[model samples]
Target: MTYFPKLLTICILACILGATTFFYVKKSVYIFDTNYFKINSVSRAALKETGSKQCKNCSEGVPNLIIQYGVGRTATTLQFQILCLMMAFLHEDEINDVGCYYNRRNLVKKYNVIKCHDISWYLTVKWSKWVFMTSNHALLSRRLNYMRGKIKDKNTTIPFIADIDLVSRRGHYIVHEYQRFFGISDEKMQHIVEYLRYWDVLRVCCGMQMSADWRNHLAPKAKYKQHHSYHSPTYPACEMYNISQVEHLLVNTYVFKKLSHIGSLRDVIGKTSTVDGILNGSYCERCNTNISKMHLKFNQNCA
Candidate 1:
């Protein structure tokens, strides 16, 4: 009887240990489903026909296919809406806001937009250009760990990795700093000032009279909070950031160290210019200049 009881106790302990190990490993890795990419018909066909993971003969005019891989808690929805509006203004079509996949109608379609959140999907797929959106580590961790009630861990815990190194060197990628969205401007610094002015007016007008869903999904009441459960059209203003926390994340994390290898916008475009300047928008020459001039015009309907 004693032996049996001891054996039973051992078995229970083993099971408990196994379960703990499983949960720990699972939490450490990013969890996603097969449909995460939602690869559309056009991309599916392209992959099948080419038997390669690269878009051939891509140029700057209108990308054959553009993948916007916005990191979680990184103002993805905001960027998506902004890009969609810009596309509409430019008369472009076939933008899928959910996942990074699109079907082109014809040659005149110019380009298609697909928002991809899966880092795994981004690493495996092929596309003409990638618009990578992310924020500093401090802000990303805070939002990811946000809960209305009690906290789980005493110290900061990062369940997923959003390092810049995951970006593939085989293709073209543009790392757009999320912080810049707040004070977005060009070399001259006028578009975003005007854009923010319009954004403020829309926020007030819709904030007072909008439906519950509209208010929750479109505009966040708090500056630090995200616009929606999923994505936001704009990041909180620069004033909302915790400067001390931002500095802490920068100094403590190795992720930001990888960015040092990436050349700043002012630096001569060379092999090291693997990505557009990530740490600050002031260093991002292309984004500050081209993006302002070529794209990003205000649209009334988005409100």
Candidate 2:
């Protein structure tokens, strides 16, 4: 009887060890799934085809497709919340495909938005001195700029609903920062100024809320000028503009269509719609000039 009990104990221990090893190995490996890329989804394929055709007029490269899958009905909202959570925990790394996949699968449904906001707030309170320092700001800005360039080049736009959530989160961060510094006195006015400043920073770093007229006009002209009457748009240029327009349309379809959304707005305006144009030139003359001045002022302040 004693021998049987000892054998049972050994077997149980072996099983426990085996299970732990399996989990450790599983956690260590990063796997990419076709579902993550929406490879088998019709919606993803269609979006890719449309995006590729549209981006061909731009000078930069674009992703062949923009894919959206679901973690449930609330996937978009959950995804945004998860992004905020990961940014809080992971410290803004390169955001590789594998990292994105793992983070999405692991965290999306596990945390609610309110929970995420609390965790993020806790992190900011505990780590703000380390995280939100001026030196870190430059690093964060560069990382965001790099990500923006990658998205622009791939011609892949994030989903509009998700973008809205990101904008909202950014706005919240701005207000939070103001409250930390300014307190409750004049809170309302400070909130508005902070919101505008937040948006301005987003426009500069994230390429949010772009005008479609720039893509329609400037992209084609840049293509033509670069290729010297290449006559028809090339694949890359077509893909870039297509992605750009679709992204812009997703955010503002009616506004995009009303702005003479056509081929090559730049030729008419006498300019080029390179990545710089897409980033800085897509706005109307007034907004563009204002953004430029703000950029100058920002640089001066940084200096």
Per-model lDDT: 0.32, 0.30
How many clashes in each structure?
A: 2, 23
Score candidate 2 by TM-score against the native.
Answer: 0.21
RMSD of each: 18.8, 22.4
**Tens digit per residue, CA lDDT, model 1, 69-151:** 44543434334434332332233123221111222222233444455555344333344433434333443345422420111
Candidate 1 stretches greater than 4 Å from native: 1-59, 90-110, 139-303
Minimum summed lDDT over a 10-residue window in model 1 is located at: 265-274
Lowest lDDT block of 10, candidate 2: 126-135
lDDT of 2 by residue, 77-158 (tens): 2233223222222221321221222112132222211212112222322111111111122222243334334433543442
Candidate that scores best on TM-score: 1
